[model samples]
Structure formats: structure tokens, C-alpha cells
Target: MSDLRDPAPYDALLLLSFGGPEGPDDVVPFLENVTRGRGIPKERLKEVGQHYFLFGGVSPINDQNRALLEVLRKDFAEHGLDLPVHWGNRNWAPYLTDTLREMTDAGHRRIAVLATSAYASYSGCRQYRENLADALATLEAEGRRLPRVDKLRHYFNHPGFVRPMIDGVLASLADLPEDVRAGAHLAFTTHSIPTSAADASGPAAEHGDGGAYVRQHLDVARTVAEAVAHETGVEHPWELVYQSRSGAPHIPWLEPDICDHLESLHAAGAPAAVMVPIGFVSDHMEVLYDLDTEATAKAAELGLPVRRSATVGADPRFAAAVRDLLLERAASERGIPAERCALGALGPSHDLCPVGCCPARAARPAAAGADSPYA
Candidate 1:
């Protein structure tokens, strides 16, 4: 592999992410920002916002992102890669537009982005691109030049990403009571999207229409389960589950909610379960509330031992993986031999998304710098 320090004239690395409320006062408004066009009542949002309130109305995502930024900076310096990293959130202060302006003011002409999401669906991918476009538009309106930005491919199947979660699952299993560990079932979980959106995910042809979300989650789960079995000499069964469904009741979303799956597992004579949040990078709102609170309560009702695995927040392996991904992309751009890893037989994602990839029903404009294989 080419050294990460190869002289490529990229200006900076942007850590793009879904922002969360930082305090009790920001909760309702932040939720409002997230659900703006959905027309959900504030009272209803308050009910949902209780999850944030449970932990002093703060989300762990921002701190996690900060830690990742530091790791990237330190690793880049150690590897002789000279670049500044700036962070911008999709729905909060230090917003994307402002971040872009700062980068422009600092004389950055070319940028590479690493979105927090690691999948190929619209929300997970394209929407961030669209958000980038919107942010650029705002910057252009303010008479600032927009830097050309490229996003890295999805790292979902990268060993740096997957291996840490495998370790997390094993650790969680070990923490459970011995009796519980004996009967534990692995539940792999992710966000729930509407069936239509899910079906339309990924590039046209080959992958077929939709279902990318489920397929990706399954791939991660199976890989982790296999690794767990290999490391512990235990053959634990696993199931794919969904959480964080925010769509209307009239709209059908992903099935077998984590709680529901836990109930079914208990009924099937399983003594305990370990939840692997395969879909997320950290224990944000969904993992903290849906899994820790809701799913644990359900398991308590069924007298089943339940433990949740940790997210890959600031794991050194994950940080190293990010470093490798940047190096890999740079090498590929230069026509060098680049090492690519992927889940199952899905292969590598496209470097540039094709027209009409992961089409949205109520189509939003594509974001600037949104084009990538993962998106």
C-alpha cells in the first residue's frame, strides 16, 4: 500500500455527521429540526424527546465525533499526511454551511469528507450529499467559493470497522450471567426505514431494487457472529432486528422491532440476548433509548437476560481504518494498487454514484459532494 503521505494536494478532511442536541433546552428544538417537514406535534416530539432527557438531554454522538477527529488528526500527523480536519453537523451549530465558509476562508481548495453514516441507503448516504449541496448553496450565496469535496466509500465491511464490533459483542456476552450466556441469542439491529425506500437502495441492477439496509445489516451481523464463534469457540445464533422507526403509523417500516424480537427470543426458550447495533457507529439516541431502555424493559418483563454491545466510538482500530480508507482512496485515485474489502460477495461500491441511484420518492436536490459509491 502507498504511504498515506503521498503528495496529493487535497486541502482538508471534513467530519460530517448527524448533529444531536447538547442540552435539555436544545432537545425539543433539535427534535423539531430533525422532524421539521414531517408535521409531527411538539407534544408527540416531547414524548420521544424523553429519551434524551433521561441522560441530561445530551447525546453522546458529538463527543464521540470529537474523539474521532482527534484520532484522525494524530494519526494523520504520525503518518506524515498534512491536512486539517473540520467538523460540521447536518442539523446544528458549526453547521455545514459555516464550516465550508471557514474552510474557504482558510484557503482550502479541495476537501474530502467522511460522513458518520456507513451504509448505502438514501438517508444513510444521498441525504448527506443533498445536505452538502444545500450547505454549498448557502456559502455561494454569501460569496464564498465552494471547495471540491469527495466522500470516502462506505467502510461497513472494512475489518477495522467490523472487527471492533465483533470484539464488542464478545465482551457483552461475557458480561452476562453464565446461565444467560449459555442461552444468549445475538440480535443485530439498525434504524428502520419505509419499505419503499429500502427497496430502492443501492445502484440500479445487480443488487436488485431496495433492501440494501437489511442486506448490509445482515452482512455485518453474520460476519461478527462468525468471528465471535471463531474467537470463543461458541456457535451463537443471531437474528437481524430493527429500531428507531419514526415514520407514520399508516406507513409500514422494517419489521420485528428489537423489543419484539427479544420477546420472541424469550418465548423460544432463549435465556438471554446480546444486541449488536450493527447499523450505527456509536450509541447515539437510538442505541441508548431503543436498545438500552425499551428493549431491556421488554426483556425484564420476559425474565430474559439482555445485554447491549458498545458502539465503535473512538476505537483505535476504527480510527486506523479511517486512516487506511483515506490512504486507499488516494492510492486508487493515483491508479495504484489499492486494497478493497467488502461484505460477502457485494464487492466494492462505486466511486461515483450513478444517476438515479437510491431514488427518493419525494426527491430532494442532491447535496454538493454527495456523489460516492456508498451514497
Candidate 2:
């Protein structure tokens, strides 16, 4: 459906991602970078940083991104797709601004950004675009050459994104005891955003009303469940659950936390459960701490069998999917509307995010929108 042979509109690919601390020393600084303008107190930040501290002050995301980068590079080479790839993070070293400066100085223009996030929610989508815009503004102020940055479309429903997840769910189910396999439930987990933001996700969001954010997750959960049922003939019942919610309790957020859902399933006598982290691309800190540590502990207490499936980290299929989207976008840039691959009903998201799509704050610059900042 995509042509890996052409990358005319894009000179280089930037793997834009949410950065994490590499070590204990980087924890506070990285946290500060993430919460810089939000005025979050050091005390609260320290509380949150403990999660990273527990894991030796490192978040698995950076290294995971590195692995993905290598895979993308290797896949491109193997497929004869000659495109250079660069990386930068929003909250850590090799920061976005510095990366942009480096790319511009290296004489690369018409950059295509593939954010690690694959959905349409605020944090997953808009915030990253805003981060890219801010990085561009900083570079512009520093007298750097500006590159036209276009983001790839959301791939929540894309088969490249979904197939691996189905495999993951099936693997997790197989891990359950043979006696319990037929009755296992699926808990599809994702990061929980504020309900207001969730409502405002995607185009023209107006309230905490479950916009594209919830819809996309549900579509994926259903698609995976249906496919798993078809393959295993087990008809696993599944629910979309939220995780890593950090806002004040007064501010509503996506709920039925994974652990809580596990408790309910246990009480309801579900023989076993598979924790499919369909929401995340990697076993990031949230997946590591929240699912691996916290939720696993809860399941143990309930005497419920559980297995947390691996995320799609550097899966060859996923890397190829990225290539497909890149080529598709490049083709469209040259006036060819290439066919897209999406497993769920939503299909592929907009190449250019519609105006008012996934706003994280009341005011901010965003790229790939109507009059995008990158434009």
C-alpha cells in the first residue's frame, strides 16, 4: 500500500519521542524539563521521579527508542529505502531544539517526524506537535535554518500496529494455565489522560466526552479481541482500561485502572487474564512499574493468573509499518493518494491533523494543523 522507493518530499526522518532519564542523575533534570512551564513543585516531581528511581533512575523508553531507531535504519537499508534517520526527545538529552539545530546545520530540510506515540489523544499527539513547534521556534530565534517538518498520521488502527498486539495477546493467553485459557479476559491498558483532555482529543473536541482518544482505544481493543477470538476460538471478553493517571483526584481522568480491573475480574471468577498494553509501543516506565510491578502485585493478592504481554518494540513488522506510512506520506506530498492499512473501523487518521485536533492546552503552536507552525 506504500512505496518505500520514494522519499522525495522528506530529506531526513526524525524519531521524535518523549524522553526519559538515563540514570539517577538525570531523573530530576529530565523531570524538570518535562514539567518546566507547568510550575510543578520539586516535591511533587520528586514523588513522581521515585518511579524512575525504583528502576535505577532510568526509564526504558530512551533505550527502547534507540533500538527502534536501529531497526528502522536496518529495515530501510534492507528494503533499499535510502533515508537518513535522526532522533530527539522532548524531555532529555539530545533535546528537540538541539536536534533541530543539528539537522539544519547538516543541511537537511523537509524533515518528516514520526512521533513514537501512535494515537490521537492530547499527550500522545498534540503535545508532541507543540513540542516540535517550540523546538522550531527556539531554533529560529537562534538563527538556525528552518526545515519544513511534517508528522506522519496516527496509526492506532493500522495493521502494522495491531498485528503485533494480537500476537502479544495470544502469547499472553497461552501463558495462562491450559485449564484457564478458554475463560481468560483481556485488559487493554493505556495511559490515562484527564477526562477534559480526553474529551478534547481529535478534531473539534468540546468536553470530557470521550472523543477520538477513547474511541481509538476501544476500536483497537475490539479489533484485537475479535482477531484473537478468531484465531483461538476462545472469544476472550475484553475491556479498555486506563493506567498511569497522575492528575489531582478532583480532576476526572480515564478510569478502571488496570489493577482495579484485575481485582474485579478476579472477584467475578475469571479464570485468567492477559494484560495487553495496547496503549504503549514499549514497556516504558508506566508499563514497567504500573503493570509489571504494581498490577502484578495486585493480581498475586487476588490469586489471579496474569501475564503482561510485550509491547511492539522494534518488531520488524512495526518498523516496516513506519516505512509504509513514510512512503505513503511522501507519495501524497507528490500528489498520489496511496492506499493505507488500518485494522479497525476508524481507518488511518488524517495526514494533517484537522484544526482544533487534540489540544493539550488552551493556547499553543502546533504543526500539521490548519496553518501548521511547521508550515
Candidate 3:
């Protein structure tokens, strides 16, 4: 595992993500991109856009991604890994197609992509692959050559990601009133998807149908909770909960939205609670709106003290993790036994998705040369 590639094989690293609006004017259009396929009316979208408007129509995701890009660039340079890094999004300016075209034009033939999402659900995993397919098709239509893109393995269990959540939990615990902190329960939160989609996620294994998604999140939450308890000597009870549900009411997604859980905890006489967003890589709109605004307000109204841990953004450890992943992929490509890091032990994600992994309704034929791992 200590053996490293003499020279990195990757020519570039692409940071792929779901883009967000940068200002009040961009909110409606951003929502449109998110809901393009869904037949939801414009009026309903406007109402939803109000969430972004509340925060000056800016999504922290893009900025966070930019910060991550800079961190990766600096880390790579420091390590003498001369790979140039680029950023692209599914929607908004600097679209994936344009970014890929730029990279191709710049003469990058072999590239690696690191998606912002860290889980195995359809939207989290498969959709990114589909987007890559679409981008490649767009490039072909424009008579442009597409580069070979390989996605990094998911890093949910990596110390770089998980340790930050544990640190966040400890900080949140310290912010609470002393007595309340002692009695605080921990609630690990993630975005909710339809139960069916969760069931169809990842390769079949002994862990159950949606094993990949569910097990990854559970492990992250448990690891953070255990580390926090060990560090602070607080035997806080914890549970995983869902947030930012947007589907039809009757269709069940993940259970116990953060607000509802807070109310229940309050009614059950829990003095305070801390929410750790184990399913997210950064504090995007969902984290800002759901946890910071909605859940906090609910807890306040119910006389329950609540605190949310910070998302991993530009953490040095995370930068190191990304570097390690690239090295592992490069070594594997060279027929070397890939060294197992805390993150790499999760195993390399599928370069080409397995049949029926993360099945989507109205599934379209996958475009050729899609670089997404899910594809």
C-alpha cells in the first residue's frame, strides 16, 4: 500500500457538482433546472424559490465547491502531482459540457472526477453518471472530442469526512447550556428519497436492498457519535433522520424529518439535541434551510435547544483524502494492489454501474462514454 506511482497517470481532476443560484435573480432559473423534468407548475416553483430568496438567492454550495477546488489544487501542487483541476456543475454557468470541452481543448486526455455527493442513491450517484452521459452526447453533437473521465470512489467512511462531523458534534455540544448539553440527543440528518429508490441503490449484498446508501450513512453517524462520546465523555443517544423532503405526500421517503424529530424529542423530555449532516459533503441549501433555519426554529418554538454541526468544506484532511484516492486509482490502473486508506477501504465504486443500480422512473438510455461511476 505504501508503494506509490512514480508519476500520476491522471492529467486533470474535475470537480463535478449540482450548481446553485448566486443571486436573487438566479433563484427561479435554478429551481427550474432542478425541477425541469417534473411537471411542477411555475407558481409552485416560485414558492419553493422563496427559500433561496430568503438567503439572498445564493446557495453556499458553489462557493464551498470552489473552496474545495482550491484546496485540491494547492494540495496537489504541494505533493508535486501536476494534475490541473477544473470545476463543473449539472446546472447553471460553467456547465459540465462546457467544462469538459475546455478540459479536452486544453489537451487533457485522462481525467478524474470527484462528485460532491457521497452516497449511493439515484440522485446522489446515478444521476451524476447520467449527466456525464448527457455531457458527452452534447460534446459529440458539437463535434468535440471528450476526454476519458474516471470518478473517485465514495469517501463517506474516510477519516477526513467523518472526523469533521465528530468535531462539529463536540463543538455543538459545547455551545449548548451545560445541563442541556449533558442531556442532549444526537440526530444525524440526510436528504430523503423515495423508499423504492433507496431499495434499488447499489450492488446486491448481505446488507439489504439499499445496503450501500443506508449502511454508509449509518456508519458515518455511528462513527461520529462514538468519537464524540469518547472525546466528551457524554453518552448522548443518536438516531438517523431525514430532511428536505420534496416528493408527493403519500410517497414515503426517509423517515422522521428533522423538525418532526425535534418536536418528538422535546415532547419526550429531551433537553437538547445536536444534528450532524452525515449525508452531505457541504452545507448546501438543504443544510442551510432545513437544519439552520427550519429545524432550529422548530426547536426554539418547542423550548428545545438545538445545534447543528458544520459540513466538511476545505478541510485539509479531506484534501489529503482526495489526493490519496487519486493515487490509489492511479496505482490500481498500473496493476498495483491499491493501498487501503480509511477512505479507500470502502472499495472503489463501480466505474460502470451494474444493471438496475439506482433505477429511475422514466429511465432514459445511457449515453455512450459517460464518465459517471453510476453509469
Using all chains and alpha carbons, the TM-scores for the candidates as numbered come to 0.94, 0.97, 0.93
**lDDT tens per residue, model 1, 1-375:** 145446354668899999998999999998898877889999999998898999999998888889999888888888777778899998876688888889989999777788898888889988888888777777778878667777788888888888889989989999999867866899999888887778878765524444666677777788899889988888899988889888679997888889889878877898789989989998788888898988888889999888899889788888888877777777776677777766555666666666677776675666532343222
Give the clashing residue pairs of candidate 1, or none: 129-367, 130-367, 133-367, 133-368, 198-211, 199-210, 200-210
Off by over 4 Å in 1: 1-4, 206-210, 368-375
- Clashing pairs counted in every model: 7, 0, 1
For model 3 the local lDDT of residue 232 reads 83
Candidate 2, clashing residue pairs?
Answer: none
When 1 and 3 are scored with TM-score, the better candidate is 1
Clashing pairs in 3: 353-375
Residue range 209-311, candidate 3, lDDT tens digits: 5557876777777778778878988789999899999878999787888889998999999999999888889989999999999999998899898899898
Candidate 2 global lDDT: 0.88
Model 2 scores worst on lDDT over the 10 consecutive residues at 1-10
Error of 3 at 242 (Å): 0.5
* Number of the top-ranking candidate, with lDDT as the measure: 2
Q: How close to the true structure is residue 147 of candidate 3, measured as C-alpha lDDT?
A: 69
